[model samples]
Target chain A: MESQNIKKKSVRKAGLLSLIPGLGQMYNGQQLKGFAFLAVTIAFLIELVTIGIPAFQDFVTLGTVPIRDHSLFLLVKGTLQIIITFVFLMVLILNVSDARQVAKQYNTLGYVNRSARSMLKNIWENGFPYLLTIPAYFVMLFVIVFPVLVTLLMAFTNYDFYHIPPAKLIDWVGLQNFVNMFFLSAYRSTFVSVLGWTIIWTLLATTGQITLGILTAVITNQKFIIGKKFFRIIFLLPWAIPAFVTIMSFSNMFNDSIGAINQQVLGLLNYIPFVHVSDIPWKTDPFWTKTALIMIQTWLGFPYIFVMVTGVLQSIPDDLYEAANIDGANAIQKFTKITLPMILFATAPVFITQYTFNFNNFSIIYLFNSGGPGDVGGGAGSTDILISWIYKLTTGTSPQYALASAVTIVISIIVIGVSLLTFKKTHAFSNEEMM
Target chain B: MRGILSSTKFNRFFSRFLTYLFLIVLSIIIIYPLLITVQSAFNASDLTAFTLDLHMHWTLANFQQLFTQTLYLTWFKNTMIIAVSTMIIQVIIVTLAGYTYSRYRFKGRKNGLIFFLVIQMVPTMAALTAYFVLGLIINGLDQYWFLTMVYVGGGIPMNTWLMKGYFDTIPRDLDESARIDGAGHLRILWQINLPLAMPMIAVQALWAFMGPFGDYLLSAFLLRSPENMTVAVGLQQFIADPTNQRVAMFAAGSFLISIPIVILFFLLQRNFQSGLTAGGTKG
Candidate 1:
């Protein structure tokens, strides 16, 4: 009973000490952890005072002195500082909570006498996971997360052609870029058409590939099928080749006059009386361009789904099909009831991601035709999806960084929303994690 | 009854023949361009035409020109540097992180995984200016290491999840028993886990190595100098101007790059099957 008072007192004392960032661990006799935590917190504070606060100020104002202070630099630096601070605060919280928890553990289990060597051993053994992952998080914090934040923040700024930094400063113009994309007269057509095509492309191209893949898998996996290995190799060829090469080749092949598609293959069709149109204008005509893009994508993408479905197909129990046959079910019935659902169930995540992939399939669109076949008046071409258009805006001589960022955020929202939906639907894929 | 039996036999034969025929036609569609590429690279006559001709006018000139007239060697070296760096870093980080997520049920493991998922879904190309700005800040603009890190960063989240999934299929009893034997965590991972996870690691390594070969959008955005350009970006310049496209040379370059990768893909077929089922791309 009396020992309870002492235990409670230690817990409260540890909690109080932890408010100073590392004192609690020292009190708990985790001397190294205590010192490391204190060191990190101090280092963080040093960085925060020296650069973080100033960067925050810069982020807020963008730039006060145009020639001297580059707003773009300030924006990037400030976003990095904010990310660093967030990481620091998270560590600080962990430190404090860790102190309280360790104190409680000692009270319950009874404190063991600690030596310096034992303390180091304990750290190596206990902190192994953190040791492994910290380096990765540190790398990701700058490389992936930093850029994302800058793009997201840039959406609310006017960092376009005229307002570029060093020569001129960009200021916050919240949602004006999006407003112009939707409500304004000039951009509305391009924006709507590009978005509509993006949706159409994602649905048609991804589904078309998956459907073709499934069909090929079913045919090739037939019990009596010969040379299965050879067919698999051949089908895998499209995916095995680098995508840019294939896209580049397809782009060359789709040329109206020089390309074999027009000069040879379509020429044979032109000899037919009703189909006597000499040229299809595969590049110059937007409709044919879109059609060619979809066909090329279907060709490029089908092999992956084929490989995936083939794996799933082989794994399906033969007994289920036998049972269906016994029930006097036809081939289509057995497929619809068993094969299709099983493959779809196994590959649902791939389908979602493939949609995301084709939605932003920049290489296929850009390398194929540079998203051309339309006037550049509205900052996009006839074949331009939002992602390709964003690329053009970001890469052009006078890049519209603000507008591109706005589009990126929109893509992010759609992609993230779909991924999140998949996540929820899959129930976080617990993966036997509870074990 | 005998007539019906013969009819059924005939029907079976017809269906089997149709299946074979359909497969053959599809194979032709996919393989014809590849055949054209090979033919053009050797044909000597063709410069820009994607010909379907079977006639031979073969020469080693296109490959010879690619190495001499262009910066193809330099581009190949640049691509190898980036791909190899990204692959090495990706393998190390992914295996380490995979071990942690699989073996340890530490604080925020679930949350961190989900956070990474959300972050991973954001397309790498979406942050174009930020990448430019980041390259500038790090003095990495046009630098191979910069592009390598971006590749590592872009691929890490998905690769880590895939690795973890692979690791999960590995039994925990081995590790638990190793822990009882007083083996250190690193020792356990090195001796038992890594040896067991070799297949997944191979898949991961191969995918990472191939990424730089096809990447144009980001490489183009970050790299400015001709000396630093990767093969994908370098080869495109051959065909960039409509009037000056050297299609034969482009074919030669792609032929060299694609054939070896295709061979590797075939060799790693089973490893790839499992890896994709666990949700990693061919990459």
Candidate 2:
């Protein structure tokens, strides 16, 4: 009873001492670990008080003085400091937990606390995964989280054209940008129009490519077709070229006056007696620009879909089609009932990504026409999607950083919502079952 | 009339003809711009820049000019540095994380994965301004290593998912049996599991390597120096100005750079398909 009481006291004592960083480990007879942790914790605490608290203070105020204190700098510094504090707290919790675990083992299992050298030697096998993943997570804290946090915070601030840094200070403006973006007539209309086109572009381009890909795959898969390799190689040729290069090439070739599409492409198309060709305004008009974009996207993207669908088609049993034929199914019926469902089942997740991909497709729009044939309105071009518009806002001579960030948040919500739904519906997001 | 009454044979022939015709049309549509690009690359005609100058004086002069007169070679070197480094870093980190995620079930595993998923959905481009600001803070705007690390960081979430998914499909039995034989985790991974997972790793490596080549917006925004531009950014500069656009040189440079990549792309076509469906979006 006396020995049990002493053991119980030791466990509780270990837990209590952990509040001072490394004291618990020392109590548990882990001298090396205890000293290392104690030293590091003490050093961290010193810095936390000296730099961390002041950084948070500046983060809240942005800066008490203008010009002298760059708010952007203060904002960035404060964010980093906050991340550091969070990390420190996490480490502290882990250290406390470790101390308790060791103490419990001693009390319950009569475990011996191993020598520091032995423990250190065994650490690799014991903490292999954690050690390896630490660098990745550490980099992510700054690279992903820091930037994302800054952008999110910037949305609530006044960091636009008028509030150019160094000369004038930026301040937190709490939904002012959101209000102006949505409630204000000018910005609201632009948003609606751009968003409408964006939706249309995503739908039309993605669907067009998928449909074309499926159809081509169906045709190519027909055993009656000859030179299957040749046809497939030709079909997938465009995919070999990078998207930006292809888009840029199309941009030059679709030029209003001297572009090859107006002369060579159409002239060749008109070779068939049934087809007639005329000069289409690929650049000047909004309607044609949208049309051309969809076509170009279809042309650029179909190869990927074609490749995927073909792979799916090859694995699909010939007996399914043979069975359909025995059932007196016509071509359309066989396709609708068998081929379509099989392909969709196999390829739906990727297809959903295509929809989202086209939704935010920044490069194609920007590279194609510079989101071109500038809108009659003062801001965004007629062809500018939300992403390209955001690019325009943050870049160029006069940047609207705060407004762009607000738009970014809006885009984030929509994209994340779609992605979440997709992830939830498909097990693609999780490896729990497989693992 | 009697011979013509054999409609089935005629139907087969006619269907074959229609299929060929349709394929030919698509083939032509695919090939037209490529042909024009080729033509412009070789055409030494000052009379017409982007037109279908059918009577082309085929010259390798444009290719020569692309190397000598411009920063094409420099941009290629810069891009390769970023791409290769990003690829190496991503592979190391991704493989490590992937192996752990598949084998281990420690605290925050599920949360970590979910965080990766959610974070990737947060558009990399959405944080462009912040990244630019970060560069300013760290003074890494021109630093290739910085850019490479940023690429690795941005890619980790989705690439980890891809890697983990692929690795999970690798049986735990290999690991168990290896451990039974007294092999450590690293040795088991090196000897047994890694070889099996090579195809997936290769796919991941290729995707990671290809990223720096395709990106324009981020590279353009972050890189301020003239010599620091990646191929994506530098190539665009050629045709940025309409009056002074080096259309021929642009064509030549694009053509030159594309050959090897395109060949590599087709060669690994099968591998990439697996990677594509593994839920990665470079956008």
Candidate 3:
């Protein structure tokens, strides 16, 4: 027992030994793990040095010469910087991983020489989940993290038209961009109006869908409802189709001159003959645009609600309704007392997600209107949500990367705040049903 | 024990009739556009004008023209390449990741899950700038492999959790038995857990396949060459470009695009529903 104890180090010494890559493993007596980390570090440094030298040389040769044309210097430098950083991070993570593995082994076995065959078998059994996760981590880093970092950095810089790559150098502008967005009246108004519309759009779309969805679920779940299964399937169909397809089809449907809804169906079923179909301003009028967006959103969104509510509805046992019936509860009374509560309880977290989802429901607005009538040349639309507005802000005239980043920061704050709130309210949001 | 209406001794058949009438109207409201589009795909005349007039000059000429004129076949080929490649890579990655999270007690298991969750909340659009830059840096953005990489990355988080959830549902005793039988981790996962989690695998693959198909924005922004465009982007270009503003072509093209997904949905709907139900019910 004393000899076994001699093989393991205290946790404090093990932690302190992690200052150098894989040293913790060496401290924990894991010679192989420590060696592997050392090799990886050396290899990464070698690779970085190899790629970086030429890049530095290119940058020096092209130093401060404003050519107004493309050069390989910026590309090379950027590539080198990314590679160095990435390699650096990979090493750090790998070292930490090695240390953690050593610590785990030390906890159990008191030494790292713990038979390679058993270790291999254990890894073979448990390695799949780790293997699966690594790609996702890389992807999440590249796609989500890298871009977000770039955007955040761009917020502090003047990376606009003049600073376009291969041209004049753009320096850091501090919080000036954010100041301009907030303090400048023109920017503020546009931001406010666009934000207002986005809020309205999210509310109307989500509320409309949820209300109608619940109502439909209730009706369909009722006893003696013929073809209930058929209705449920039909209701779920809209959601099954791609959002782009639905929006594109609906956009065509609502067209005033050439639209099927305006011309053939509405014309044929004309309860009011005086209002000509050709004169309808479904896409043009601001009121109609907002209405059209809401209506289209409802069509796209209701099916999700229908599907969720169906799940929630089924979870409400038959005995509850029977109990309600015995208590002299009418249909509406039964719904209020039993059904709505059960559905709401089960679906509140989903409902919060619905709110956040519609907050960025870009496909509908972009595909439907392109946030249009051009906002009467104001560069936004009556139906433009915050996400589409941010998109336009980035891609539109003058290329407001700084302003867009500020907008993103604000959006991040709101989203995080809402997420925390929702998580607090529903344990499911936090617990997340881990497999 | 009985029908509410029948037991009332007062036949409120009018309300039932009205409800049916309302539902029928609503169903038509939902279904009419699809019906119109299907009809227009067959109509010989140009449907670009978006006319309400149901001029039923029925012909398969639009479908015939689509085959003759466009690179529908090329687009189909490219889409299949992207979708299939993405599915293969994504399934392997997600399945492994899911198994790890389910079975292993790693240091950052909670943190990793949180990271994925927070990352998922960020819009895909947020990554466009970095993605474009990364592609340029690596010289990979324009290639088929690059798109597949992006697809795998994009699918990893949600799909991993989903698979993890499935793996969680699997009894650990299976693993114990496999281990006692001298099966390795990979062997157990491949031989036992994978087959048990086939529904999730199908769902993951289906989602991965559908991703590259439905995406227009990413493919459009990233893939510079016309040859690289997926069907969604290509078809949209067909509608938007004046020379190819053939609306009937769009319909026909959409019909073609819809085929795989429709088939996918029907074939996997039962499994998909059961997976979803299991996910919801377990939580």
Candidate 4:
């Protein structure tokens, strides 16, 4: 009798393990896990039986529906579902555990009869890394992955206000939402217009911010500049403060009636003959509303550019500048030849991201005007971006869930397309030394 | 003589004067809004107008009313709870993921890294609708953990990138030496890697702490019930509550809210700047 027990399962057993959820564990000689998996299956089956009966009765009869909130019942069902889900997860984990143990035993001991103590020890030692990853996996799955999947599913269904709950069944709608967005009468024009405005807004705001930011950084970084530190800190405040506060503060400043920008800053400054006054209409007017958004965005955005440029500026070898200077390069020539190219190359990815970010910049636009002056006739505000429009569709009084889902898919496609193009072209991602 | 006249002393004097002038101008730009906010917060008026003259007539009435009349405390408590929980969860997860990505040469390491990078590029709006539906599902489950999970989820990718980059900069010899000393991966991470990554951890903590503090969209959407309202969402009620257009209260609230962030900014600015600047454009 060999000391190392070389026990093996039949092919049929292996096939059975593949068929059943936890049979793999039992085959690997973890009976407890297999039994636990069976128990959870039974429990969830019971729960489904319990909830399905009445829910089915109400749905099929359609004459005399249950006259209860069923909140408690739903709660119980939800809890059971969660528990079942958890147990299913546990079974999965145990299967993996058993497989790993079996593999390790085969490798190290050449047998299936490794002591439980040794098994436990191996798990304790090598398993911590795997165990440590559980939270990350759980968070990503439940939080990001689950929701995204659910929303993707919802996009395929009629989960609008009319189809809230028990009263109505949310049958699949296919690509009707997308169809509605593109060609349908209700939203086609509004969607196209809002999307156009969004693109324009993103372009203007991002460009303005980057332009101002580079200008400020250039000016401040100059040897001749005074109070460089002070200017730097001042410029950085927008980045420091929560964006909500900055936008809110500026919105108030740009308010039509009592806004300080109008009443004080501009009111005082615009009195001068050279300055074009005529009451800038920061909020109400279409052109000025967009302008206000751009200005505030510029103010908020420039700081990041400043910081990035500053870093790039510091890293730029002084020899390049010295060489350029020696070659009789004027300040403009030197900046054009050396500074501009260097910073652009270093920050091209960030520059592209800024555009995409502004494209989806919901917070500022929403807070600034709630995408308002409402698109009563045109369907969205002069300042309304695609993101805000989506927000309106989702949270609007009518609650256009299907439409919102369509918008989401559209935005995702656009973002994915743009990012892929950039990634492929610049290989900006190749430099992302992830870890 | 001319060269001597243009010496270090003269240059220093000239620079000093310009510095002072620039500082004064920039300080005004930075400090003016803050002053206005503070003044507006203290003003006792029907309309919280930003009038210098009116602002001069400061009063504690706005703060008094905020404490006395509104759900400000509840909002504060909610915001703090959310922020703190988010910070803790973020630090733990980011710390783990970051270290793993930084040190471990696992099979899916490159794939995972690129996945996170692309995911990071996916703007909040793209995923937001999905998140809202997620919230509803979780809310259906009747758990606060669901919303917390979302915050933690959104934060992990960015913070992981940040912390991972920071971790990569830490010398690998420490991990190697720890392994030689009979410490396991977790033990080494806990005992050695984490301590070295503290500054980056602090940066992660700050951003996570501020996340729930300033967020409005998710909180507003997810936390439908008034009792669960964060300060950011609660503050919005002031504007939407047409009867109570006490814009001063919003300003007062804004003023109060800005404190922790300001302190955080000043305290963590060094780590924040260094962490972002150095790790952001890794080649």
RMSD (Å) of each candidate, 1 decimal: 2.4, 3.2, 4.2, 5.3
Q: Write the per-residue lDDT of candidate 2 for residues B84-154, one digit (tens) a residue.
A: 99999999898888777777887777788778778877777768889988998888888897788789998
Q: What is the DockQ of candidate 4?
A: 0.39
Give each model a TM-score: 0.95, 0.92, 0.87, 0.83
> How would you encode candidate 2's per-residue C-alpha lDDT over A1-435 as one tens digit per residue?
544655453667888899898899988888888888889898888998999888888888888667888989988898888788888888899889989888987777665446867786667867887887887798888788899899999999999888877778888999998998898888888888888888889889999999999989888888877788888888887777877788888888888877878876777778899999788899989889888999999998898898777777777788998998999998889989998988876777668778877888998999999988868343689999989988988886788899889989998898889877875686543435532
Ranking by lDDT: 1, 2, 3, 4
**Model 4 over residues B6-98: C-alpha lDDT tens digits?**
896797788668756655665566666666766778777666455555425668888888988988887888788878888898889888987
Summarize candidate 3's per-residue lDDT along A1-435 as a digit string, tens digits. 644555555666666676577788777776766777778778767866886565555444433455642333353354446646676886787676667666776677655654667667666555555665777676666666666766665566666666666666555678887787777877777778888887888888999998888888777776788888788667777766766766777777777666776777777666676754444688788788788889888877887677667767876788988888888889789878888888776667557667877887777887776787546223567677667776776667766655666777777667768766776767755455442
lDDT of 3 by residue, B1-283 (tens): 4687576644557668767886787798787777777677787777674443356888889878878887787877898999999989888878788788888776668888777666656665644555666678778877888777877776776666667767777899989988999997668878898899898788778878887876766776677687777887777765565354677777777777786787776677666655654444333
Computed on alpha carbons, the lDDT of every model, listed in order, comes to: 0.85, 0.82, 0.71, 0.71
- Look at candidate 4 and tell me the lDDT of residue B278: 53
Q: Is the docking of candidate 1 incorrect, acceptable, medium or high quality?
A: medium
- For this target, which candidate reaches the highest lDDT against the unseen true structure? 1
Question: For model 4, how does the per-residue alpha-carbon lDDT over A1-435 read when each residue is reduced to its tens digit?
Answer: 443466544444544563455565567665655666667666656766786455444333322333343222342234335445666666665655555555455445555534567657766766665566668766776666555544565576666778654565455667888887788765788887788888888889999989877866776776766557667667778777777876777777777877887788777777688987656777777777887888778877888888878878878899998998888898689889999898887777678778888888888888888777647332466577877776777777777676776677688778768877986687666765543
Deviating ranges (above 4 Å) for candidate 2: A1-17, A268-276, A317-330, A376-378, A426-435, B1-15, B47-53, B274-283
lDDT of 4 at A49: 79
Off by over 4 Å in 1: A1-9, A29-35, A112-116, A268-278, A426-435, B278-283
TM-score per model (chain B): 0.94, 0.89, 0.88, 0.88
Best by DockQ: 1
